[model samples]
Target chain A: MLEAISDWLQSTWLSHAFISQGLWAWPMSESLHFMGLCLLVGSVGLIDLRMLGMARGISVAALHKLVPFGVGGYLVNVLTGSLFVIGDADQYIFNDAFRVKMLFMLIAGLNVLFFYSSAFQKTKLLGPDDSMPLNVKIMAGVSLTCWIVIISAGRLITFYRP
Target chain B: MEALFIWIETSPLSLWVRGESGWHMAFPIIIVFHALGMGFLVGVALAINGRVLGLAPQVPLGKLRQFLPVAMLALVVNVISGILLLIGYPTKALTNPVFYIKLLCIALALWNLRWFSYSVLTNPIYDHGVLPQKTRQLATASIVLWASAIIAGRLLAYTYNNMMSI
Candidate 1:
């Protein structure tokens, strides 16, 4: 059954269209993906660092303004990313590099969710700069690590082009 | 410079970089570094720029400055590795219009970054503990430039015209 499904997917007209048109679309999507990543990293990093008390001088409320850009970045990533998968489904499905990259992406996404749902709630929007709790700091550290892993995993995918 | 590129291509490291290593081995390792480099430079830069724009309202403006060192370090790593990769296939990248676009994006990103540092981020406004309105403008521009640069870089693989140039 699995082989049959794979065979069907490989021969699907949708897949053929994407691959043929992807000559231009793929690059365009890739460009957008990178841009989105930049957005995610930039705003998210600032907020995370604030949790670590990096800028004791600035008001937390002001920093929160950047979160929207981070969200915007994620939106861009999702849109561009789906194109790549649709264009070359199998390249990611069975590829080890792609597998690892996906793993990192999951971890990063979960890390953000965890931060927002739990730590962020506790930390409040604009808490005192020097008073951030240790848990929040830990959360920030985890987010940073997850992002790093995601980036590395993404780069490795190219080299591991299966 | 051309001779240097030729010589580096002959180096053992370059040989390995260019060699077709078995999957799940050397190739993935290099790719990991490349991705990390991208995240470091583009990812971190964007994050920092967001802060300048007033994203993390709670964080002190001064604290956001610290990330610059990290971003700079990431850019340095990318340049070195990127050069090595270029040596591995000088003709492929040099001949590509997409590659030139990527480089131009990077140049613009860096140049804009410098402007961000001087005009907005490191300016006296942060020292005064005030979120001057001007910082917001700078932050917005930074986000745009950095994001565009990343897009350009990603498009390089798809847009190259040929494998050889000159």
Candidate 2:
């Protein structure tokens, strides 16, 4: 089923442009991807660290404002990452590394949902001296680990390409 | 310079990284760390700079300094990984002007951070009040510098003329 979808997607005009005129496309997407990665890590990661008990003095609510930047970064990455998938469908669709990356991203997304639903309100009200709940700490750890894994797996994609 | 490149490239460490040995795994692992480090360094820097530029006004600038250590840790990771990468392909990086541009941008960004720390962060007024014009300027420059550094670093992969000497 996945192969069929990839085959269909590969035949599209968008995919053709990504492959034929991809000399500049790949690098441009890659650069933007890096930038977006930085943005996401900087804002979201920092807040996660804070929740994990680092930089406790900074108000969690204030740091929450930076989450939008991270969201923006995520948007940029999604667009570029899709272009990559559309451009060389086989390179990612069947690749183990890409699969792992997607898994990590899924885990991250679920973790975010859990955070907002379970811990966001309580955590945001935390004072400098307030102790973080174990669940929030766990969420932060999961977030950091997921992002690091995502990056490592993304890099490994080239090495493990099918 | 050619002789130097050959000497460095032929070194055991470099050979191992470039060769088809188990140690070849080190090359990509180090690159992975490099990317991770870049994300931490640039990401934290952007956060701090964003705050200074009035993105998160409620957060105290002084408190943000706590993350400096984390950023520094990332910088150290990058430097070590960067050196290893250069060792693996000295001819590739050293021969390219983009490499130097990337380094210069990193240097400037670090310098800008230092200036901001000394001038703005240390000032008690900036803790809760508005940031001064000069500090905002430094923050703006820092964002530009780090972005340029990232772009230049990314370009090095495509712009290099030589991959290895040996």
Please report the candidate that would top DockQ against the real structure.
2
DockQ of candidate 1 is: 0.57
lDDT of 1 by residue, A123-152 (tens): 665445456778778878888777776666
Question: TM for chain B in all models?
Answer: 0.76, 0.95
Question: Candidate 2: where is the Cα deviation over 4 Å?
Answer: none
Q: A61 in model 1: Cα distance from truth in Å?
A: 4.6
Model 1: per-residue Cα lDDT at residue B37: 68
Q: Per-candidate TM vs. native?
A: 0.79, 0.96
Q: What lDDT is reached at residue B95 by model 2?
A: 90
Lowest-lDDT window of 10 residues in candidate 1 chain B? B20-29
Error of 1 at B144 (Å): 4.9
For model 2, which pairs clash?
A: A42-B43
> Each candidate: RMSD to true structure?
3.9, 1.3
Give the per-residue lDDT digits (tens) of candidate 2, residues A1-162. Answer: 999999998999999988788457788788889999999998999988988889967878888999999999999999999999998999999999999999999999999999999889888888865668898889999999999999999988888889
Score chain A of model 2 by TM-score against the reference chain A.
Answer: 0.96
Best by lDDT, which number? 2
